[model samples]
Target: MLLTLAKEIGFSHAAAVDPSSLKAQQEVRELCAADRCGHYGRNWSCPPYAGELTAAQKQLARCTEGVLVQTTGNLADEFDIEGIGRLMQLHSRRFATLARQARLLYPKVLPLSAGPCTVCRHCTCPTRPCRFPQKRLSSMEAFGLMVGDVCRAAGLPYSDGSKTMTFTSCILIMQ
Candidate 1:
């Protein structure tokens, strides 16, 4: 069922990642604090707001299996940052929706999106508390995941050099 959904959603690659392959929590925290992605403190799901990476890692460790999903979209050029962002959000929402359904089959499913959680147009996540914790998902980078490594391990191409936009998302299922 999940595979079918991945295909339907235009995901070029989809496979389950081993939870054991995740990186150390401290390493993740360092990367988040570095704020290279620029979303580190700006988004609710990013660092400085999402809680300690150690805690996140511990939480994810409970999961045994995870699925990596990707979607590739064409863009005019590299300057299309807005276009890429929009495409990513579109895929992110779709990924979350599918993840919700997957949770029905696997009660302990944890979704890790391609980017920060965008459950609300204007997130009130950290100010108070996550408005929808159950539906929210962290990014692979947040967990110190070397996305390219994981993608290669899962037999998925991390890039195609098409000068276009591509989005990837993942969900961990605790079996």
Candidate 2:
């Protein structure tokens, strides 16, 4: 029922992952510390501002179940930056829509996306309050989650193969 609802809401793939199955790694936190994704300190949904790793872990602990969602798009090439950005944007929109729908069905949910919140071209983080706190989605990485490991634990593929870009997001549902 969850997977079907997810797909109907536009997720290409969805699976239930037990929250207890998630294992947070300091190594993943290190990647954020490195600013490899480049949005580290620039966005409200990313690192430093997203809160401590322990806090993220605690948030996840409150949820008993989650749905891993993926939207995979075929890239023209590895250097298709434009294609990649477009795909990510598309995936984010779909994820946000699904999240809102899920929120209606579920009493409480925490939606984590593949990247920082793009609800606005310029985020008003640190300087001002989030304009859409209710809609703002946090990044999975910022939540101290290793997307690949989480996918594996959920019996899902992190990658559909090379030349294909996959954006992953998860909705932690409290029941």
Candidate 3:
């Protein structure tokens, strides 16, 4: 059912992995500490706010496998940061919606988005409890998983060129 949904969504690739295969929490911490997202320590779903990667791994451990999924959007050039951002935002919302539907189908499913949890237009993540805890999700990068590596493992092409914007997201199915 999940695989079918992924295909319906235009995902280029999808595969399942044991949650244990994910990297360690400390590694995620170090990556976050580097402040790659700028929101590393600022957002509730990033670094200090998201807690250790170990915690993420532990939570994932309860799940039998995680389904990695990717979506690619064509762009005109590298300077189209705005275009890329908009495309990502669109994909993020679509991913979340699909995740919710997935949860209805598989009650134990847990979604981890491609980037920081973007449930709120402007997150009060640092200052307040998440507006939608059940819907909020963390990005794969936040867990210290080099996304390109993961995509390659899933048999997906991570970089087509500067003319394409690729977004990856995942869900852990505990059943």
State the lDDT of candidate 3 residue by residue for 1-175, as single tens digits: 7777877876766776556665644655677688867776567777777766667667666777677877778887888988898888777877887798897888787787887888888888567777887777777777667776666666667777768988888787875
For model 1, how does the per-residue alpha-carbon lDDT over 1-175 read when each residue is reduced to its tens digit? 6676666766667887777877645666687788777777777777777767677778777888777898787777888888888778778768977787787887787788887887777667546767887777778877767778878777788887777766778878765
All candidates' TM-scores? 0.86, 0.92, 0.87
lDDT (tens digit, per residue) of candidate 2 on 1-175: 5577788877778899889877656787789879877787788888788887787888888887888999888999999999999889889888888787888888888888888887788998778888888888898888888999999988889998989999999888865
Inter-residue clash pairs, candidate 1: none
- Clash counts for the predictions, in order: 0, 0, 2
What are the per-model C-alpha RMSD values against the true structure?
2.1, 1.5, 2.0
User: Considering lDDT, where higher is better, how would the candidates rank from best to worst?
Assistant: 2, 1, 3
In model 2, how large is the Cα lDDT of residue 31? 90
**How accurate locally, in lDDT, is each candidate?**
0.76, 0.85, 0.74
What TM-score number comes out for model 2? Answer: 0.92
lDDT value for model 1: 0.76
Worst 10 residues of 3 by lDDT: 16-25
* Colliding pairs, model 2: none
